[model samples]
Target: MSVKKISRHSPPNCGARAASASVLALMALLGAAAQAADTYNSDRPGGADHRLLSRYQGSLLYMYGEEALGKADMLFDDKGKPVMRPVEGRISNRMYWGPKKKSPLEVYRNYRHALETAGFKTIYACETKQCEAGAVQDAVQDLPRKVVWKDSDIFVENTFNSANQPGFHYYSGRRTGPDGDTYVSVALAGGYEDEPVFGRVRQFVQIVEPATAELGKVSVDAKAIGGALKRDGRIALYGVKFDTGQAVLRPESTAQLAEMAGALKAAPALKVYIVGHTDNQGELQGNSTLSQKRADAVVAALSSKYGIAPARLLGRGVANLAPLASNDSEAGRAQNRRVELVVR
Candidate 1:
């Protein structure tokens, strides 16, 4: 028998025990004999119905109870800024725990029960096992997914998992940001859209909303892009040696110079401000000075090697005033040390 799995990021006993017990109880009430013959759909209200919605939402909502604690653990990047990453992908899974004779739909209903019992606040879309390809929007568009595992679309859970915790998932889509550049995404599980089935009849769903145009598949030349964008915007560089806590520009940093040069050529009119940020490890003032030094170093590279007009370049030092990670830990502090570019 395929055992149901909770978000596995936490200690099994800490945040997940209630959901487990609830699922077990619901299964007992529904009778172990229940089986699903087909998947559920929202359009066919009679087919899947509000009863199922209540069940699904109830489970997901229960799961959300632990979200508060998860959010507490999040850390910011340097400059006390939250890191902005985009959605990667969404994934879902389900298992059969009830009677062996039910229709696939009935079996999927039980799967919803399990998710509900486990505390997920979810909504149903196309209850059937069909999904369309290509960029799809709308609540139902996300569901009715073609289940390769069992060939059906079941339900879309409505609640989101916090990024701070384990077992949560993310979704990705394409959209244009205010800056008009495409970026990639990272989001909570069930944020994207997908349907999965297992053990012959059970169903699960993953949801992803449309993304900003700024996000897409990451380009291979992010470093190059970094350079070009730097000239028109604030750009800073630090010498980084892999696996070392120290910061200094290495030979590879020259690549960033090319990026800045490219940006300068693209938008000669754009002005930029470069500031440095660092993780809080040692003296705050010292950290600030180091960050400033890194920014100055980048400025010097652009002026001396690339021969960019000095009027377009500006640099300043900022120390531990910005951090990408936590000072409490080495990893956080390491990520904290860096440079920033402000585009005007």
Candidate 2:
């Protein structure tokens, strides 16, 4: 009798409401977990001390021992040429975005300070109007065209534009690491007072570790060269080195030159077409000119220094026309940027 009196009525669909609330709570938990998975921690590798606005992306261009060109400056000359003083090393490019209410200047300063604390000395730094010159804009636009990987250029451009919002800011620096010298370039923009939507700072960091190997002694002797030539009709040479953005050969190239000279001397009837190749890094015309100059330099060295007849070797710059490997990677680029002796 007491139980029947107590079991009167349900409280206005309370059970349904409780079930709905439980479902909502479960969904909320799932949403939070998904968001956490998408967003990286502030201390993510190669990221600054800021909340990651979104997922982080990176491209390891050149491996530990490969060469990479690091941008030392972002400004341009009065003649309109973007002053890209390139630093060579093992290159890695990384990007991250931070959603914060901080101003552009504040974000720039925070990144700069972090870099300094991490032992990076500023190579170049600029802010606002100083960084918004026509040359800078052109450089930003032309980067995709110049780089071998289009995604990297796109990432850089989008990050730079977003972070630098109303104006622009750029920072580049270097630090000595255990492996080698680590170069860092940071481009910060966003949080412009003029734009309401621009509140996120984007950072593009390029780390270039110095190459570990240099041309040592002449490993490829005359016999080896002759055999390779006899078998392949063409032999690609790697030890022939050059300074970054220059036609001049490094002193380390002496061993390779000597070996090449010895090979020609051993074979009296051997004449080769000295073909120069390069990785796709800059303008096609400029690379063609550079390859030509590099070939000329090699020929000149062989003839004048090693007493090989100039007529026996014809210098030709094919630029990146022929690549032995894919140009998508640093190792491949290193392999492509070589001198080849083709039987004429």
Candidate 3:
């Protein structure tokens, strides 16, 4: 996090204010272009950035959600300003950073550049002044996330979360397809200064068509789990069902969870690691953390919901570091994202 700077040098006598403004603008642009210590291509929470876009360089993917058929809030910088336009279809919610100089224009532009490169044609966009006056900020200081677990991604989340919340602005995208013209909307919340600013915040809400999951065709039983773990020392089980961006176990997973508890009960001396996996299709931002949380959730369910001994189940995540199949296809990616009972 950066603190507000106070220059001690005396002001220049000629065109001093103009020089200051010019310098500030230059700094804002430079900050937008500044790369973090490592390259971050965090396009996650689902299958490789469904909109075909990656996050802005140096930005971490804080939170994302998707639904096959849903609705998104559409914002326009037009006469109506920040007023909402709700559109229905396959909905996805993605909130990203506004590591700002307080002047959101610089960071906002760079973020948009990343989106535009993915072939979306911008139809509407705006900065603070362009929005309607008296529009309210989001309900809270920080946008709520689905799960708030401490992961390596938390450090970067802390960095962006510290910035002051600013006014709402927007940009929309339209792409022509054989089906029709699909729209994409991005709303930016930006401020206007540099001396005391450190973050830029924006959100994108989209609706994409829903699709079916071919997973969960078979449920693993206690016999199968024990046999596999005994023979191979581990078993990749897709019986556990987790939604695209969800960390909690679904009610439908009760059958498999019961079977797991059964296997544990049958073998008193056995202990296993409930390892979680997510396919690395687009980005690696919070995949490991997300995977860890999912694994932990499974462990919690087995212990509290069922009667598995807590000490016997250790949970961990391996991100996309290990993949059982290629990420080039949805089928292969599904196979890659699974939970395994690895004997300890």
What is the per-residue lDDT of model 3 for residues 1-344, given as tens digits with 9 covering 90 to 100?
A: 99866566855454778888899999987776553322232433443344555555554454566666444555544454445555545555555554444344555676577658867676666655544433323411232232222233442233224333455555677665533446666555552233222344454334343222567757899998899989999988888988887898877788888888888889999999999999975557689888999999999999998888899999999889889988665656888989889999
* 1 versus 2: better lDDT goes to: 2
Q: Where in model 1 is the C-alpha error above 4 Å?
A: 1-248
lDDT of 2 by residue, 1-344 (tens): 35433345666668899999999999999999776544433333333322311122321121011124433333324354336666665555445554555556766677678778878777666777766653354355333333333244333444434322554567677786544566666665563342322455555545566553333334576778889988998888878888777999988888888889988999889999998899888989999999999999999999999999998999999889998878765556777888889999
As a TM-score, model 2 comes out at: 0.40
Which structure among the candidates has the greatest TM-score?
2
Model 2 lDDT-worst window of ten:
58-67
Q: Considering lDDT, where higher is better, how would the candidates rank from best to worst?
A: 2, 3, 1
Q: Please estimate how well model 1 matches the true structure, expressed as its whole-model Cα lDDT.
A: 0.40
lDDT of each: 0.40, 0.65, 0.64
lDDT, candidate 3, equals: 0.64
Listed per model in order, the count of residue pairs whose N, CA or C atoms clash below 3 Å is 77, 3, 8
Q: List the residue pairs that clash in candidate 3.
A: 90-207, 90-208, 98-199, 98-200, 98-201, 99-200, 100-199, 100-200
Better of 2 and 3 by TM-score: 2
